[model samples]
Structures are given as structure tokens and as C-alpha cells.
Target: MTTEVSTRPLQTLLAFPFHEDRWQSKMLIGIGLTLAGMIIPIIPGLILMGYVYQIMHRVIVDRGSLYLPEWDNWGKFLKDGWRLFCVAFLYSLPTLVVSFAGMGIYIVTFIGAMTAAGNHPDSPASILLFVAIGILFLSIGLSILTGTLTFLVLPAALGHTVARDSFSAGFDFTGWWKIFRANTGGFLIALLVITGLMGLVYIVSQIFSMTIVLICLIVLLPLAVGFYVMLIGAALVAGAYREGVENLELAELKLAEASIVAVQEEKPS
Candidate 1:
């Protein structure tokens, strides 16, 4: 008798070929475009985000990899990015509403608690308690809900569907919670590593003694770091999406192939 192996749950879509040909060149170009996008000043951040979104969708989703043509079709990418931004903005309304509404409730609860405690302004204990409880609830609720939304709803938006349909798709995709749970440790580790690297970059620049280099650093460092961070995030999200979809396709293919093999074996050989 042979022991059977259990099928592991699917991990987040992260299928980008980080080690493949011309990836570094594409990454550098992507970062540069992201930085130039920052020069617009007022809405530069949003524009930069749009650019990153475009690169991810166009290069990763459409091209089947992140090794894209360097600045060859940026205008088209930007257009797609803008379209995605608008859709994502609309999709995110519920999250924004929940955040503000939750904040309002916390404020109201705090005020009520303070009033009940006494008219004394020195009573911070009650306020502290209110904040602690509020933050705890927010952290738990927001992390889980946002994680689920990002994992599920993003696919529909990426696929250019309506908000309601996207949300429904998210609900369906999110039913496989075990996959998310299994990958939690890896996600947390990656998050910490990225955070540490960013912090180190900030710290090293501040400690440098060369005045001219320091001045240049002060101006360019934040933008560089920000762009790089955005690129990494976009890549990771794109990878997760690809991984999920491909895995689903692979499973279907395997089942079909197995069925064909069974039928052929029964017929003659």
C-alpha cells in the first residue's frame, strides 16, 4: 500500500519571474517612470500609484511577466492605470466609509466615557481605555477584512468588471480561507523584511557626512525609496493574482487529463 500526500492549499499569486532575463532593466525603468510621475507635485502620489498599477497590469498581467518593454508604450499604460485607479477608487469606498465611521464611533465613545468618568480634565485613564479597545478592534477587523478584499475583489477589478460583480467574485474566491491562513507566516516575514530595508535606507542617508551627497540624497532618497516600495508592492500583488489563476487552471487541466487517461486505459491498453 502507498501513502497518499494531501494537496497543499494555494498560496497568494506571486508568479512573476524575478530572476528571469531583463527583469532588472525593466525594474529600473519602472522605478524611473514612477519617479517622473512624482514630479507632478499635487496629485503626484496618485499619479505614481497609477503608473505602478499600469506596469503591473500591462507587463505582468498582459505580457505574462514583468520583463516589459522599457518606456515603449507608457502612454497606453498610463491610460489603463487611470482606468484602474478610477475603478479601484470606487471599489474602496466601502473601506473608507467603514474607517471613518469606526473612527467617529471611537470618538463618540471616548467622549461619552470621559463625561461619565467626571468633568475633571486630568482623567486620562478612561480615555486611554477607550483608545486601547478601539484600536484593538480596528486592527483585528481591518486586517482580516482588508486582506480578504485584497485577495478576492482585486481579481474582478483587474479583470475590468463592475463593482458588484467584482465584490461577488471576491466573496466566492474568499471561501478558500485556508490558503490565506497557510501563507500568513510568509506574508508577515516579507512585510517585516521590506520594512527593515526601508528603515535602513532612511537611516543610512541621514548619517552620511558628505554635504553635497547628503543634499542630493535628501532630495532624491525619499522619492527613490517610495518608488521602489511601490514597485515591490505592485509586483507582489500581481504575482499573487497570477499564482491563484494559474493554479486554478492547472487543477482543471490535470482533472481533464486524468479523465482522458482513464477512458483510454479502459478501452484497450
Candidate 2:
């Protein structure tokens, strides 16, 4: 049976990383992933993303804590990372298209206006400028909204994807809809926890980037804030996934028992 105790989401989610067991080493992995993630041709970042997903998988499936996952599964990590990349990429398509189109429109409008001004054309440059501003704002707002949706849905998609060990699992829209419907409150709470962590990371980093000494800290520990926030976010999603699976499992067990009892009732006494 799934453990129903320790239901406090944040507390349970953080218990692993905060535990007294080799937390320093776990932190070292976080730091390493963060710094390595900052480098180059997307490989390092993808690996780190896969590793974090594995950490979430362990928690949600194996009922493990937020302990650091090992780097030994490089092949598996690459594969999983590739799939997660697919999921994220697919989900971000709308946001990407909107953002690029927005930027393109802004650039074209800026250049056209500049030429008009330089040539002193009779066209209403002022009106064009106002129209450009409105278009820019609207496009930017749409991009931001879509980007936010990507962040919100990616976690749920990732959870399902990893749970089934299939990339297509994440795209199972009907299944996800049911899961979301059944666990809306818990899922929102999880999202809220992650959002809070985001704000905290921003505040802490700003505080750490003030003086020369602190600015140096930020430079030396460039990935610290990001890694910490990511770890917590992964854990919150893991907890939410576990809760959803547990509910489904419990319902299945009850249904099985009910069927057995009904069969017995139909049998001769």
C-alpha cells in the first residue's frame, strides 16, 4: 500500500535533500549540474534535466526521498533527456512561434520607421509608432502567457512521461485531463509551492548580489540559486505525482474488493 502519512507537501518534498545523509555530496551534484548546465551545446543542460527527472521518478515511483541521483546512467540520462526535451519542445511551440513573430514584427517596424524618419516621408510615422507599440505589447503578452503555460504543463507532462517510461505518455491528453481533474487542489498546491520557491530564489540571489563580496559569491556559485529552486520544484511535482497515483491505486483496490464481495454474495451460502 502507498504510504499516506507525511502528507505535508513541502515538508515531505524537502525531507530528502535536507536529511543528514550525505547532503553535502548531494549539494555538490546540484552545484556541478548547475555550472555544467551553463556551458555550451545543450548536452550538459539536457543531462542535468534528465537527472532531475530521474530524481523525481525515484521519489514518485520508488517512494524514495529527494536524494541526489547518480551520474552512472549516462546513456539512460541521454535518452530520457532527449524525450523530456521533446516534451518541452512540443509544449513550447506556441510560445516560441509567438515570441519569434513578435520580435520579427518589432524589428521590421523599427527599421521601416527609421527609414521613414530619415527620408522624411509624408506617411504618419507617429501613428505607425503607436500601432507598433500596441502590436509589440500584445505579442509580448501572448508570448508570456504561453510561456507560463509551458512551465505549468511541462511538470505534469514530465511526471506522466517518466511514470510510463514513454515519451508518448506525456502527450496523453485525455489521461492527463482526468488526472488533473481528480487532483486539481493538490496539483495547484504543488504549483504554488514551486512558484514560491521561484520568488524565494530571485530574492535570495538579489540579496547575495549586492556587495563586492556577495557579488563574488554569485559569480563563484552561479548555479546555486537555480539548482536549489529546480530541486524543490522537481520534488513538489514528484509528491503530486505520487499523490495522484496513490489515489488511483486505492480506487482500483476498492473496486477489486467490491467485485470479489459481489461474487461471494452471488455464491451459495
Each prediction's total of clashing residue pairs, residues at least 3 apart in sequence or on different chains, is 4, 0
What is the C-alpha local distance difference test score of candidate 2? 0.77
Q: Which stretches of candidate 2 lie over 4 Å from their true place?
A: 1-9, 249-269
Clashes by residue pair, model 1: 13-239, 13-240, 14-239, 14-240
* Lowest-sum lDDT 10-residue window in model 2: 9-18
Query: Which pairs in model 2 have colliding backbones?
Result: none
The CA lDDT of each predicted structure is 0.55, 0.77
- For candidate 2, the per-residue lDDT at 57 reads 83
User: In model 2, what is the error at residue 109, expressed in angstroms?
Assistant: 1.9
Query: What's model 1's lDDT at 248?
Result: 57
lDDT of 2 at 26: 68
For residues 127-157, could you state the per-residue lDDT of candidate 2 as single tens digits?
6666677778989999999998777667778
Best by TM-score: 2
Quote each prediction's TM-score.
0.54, 0.83
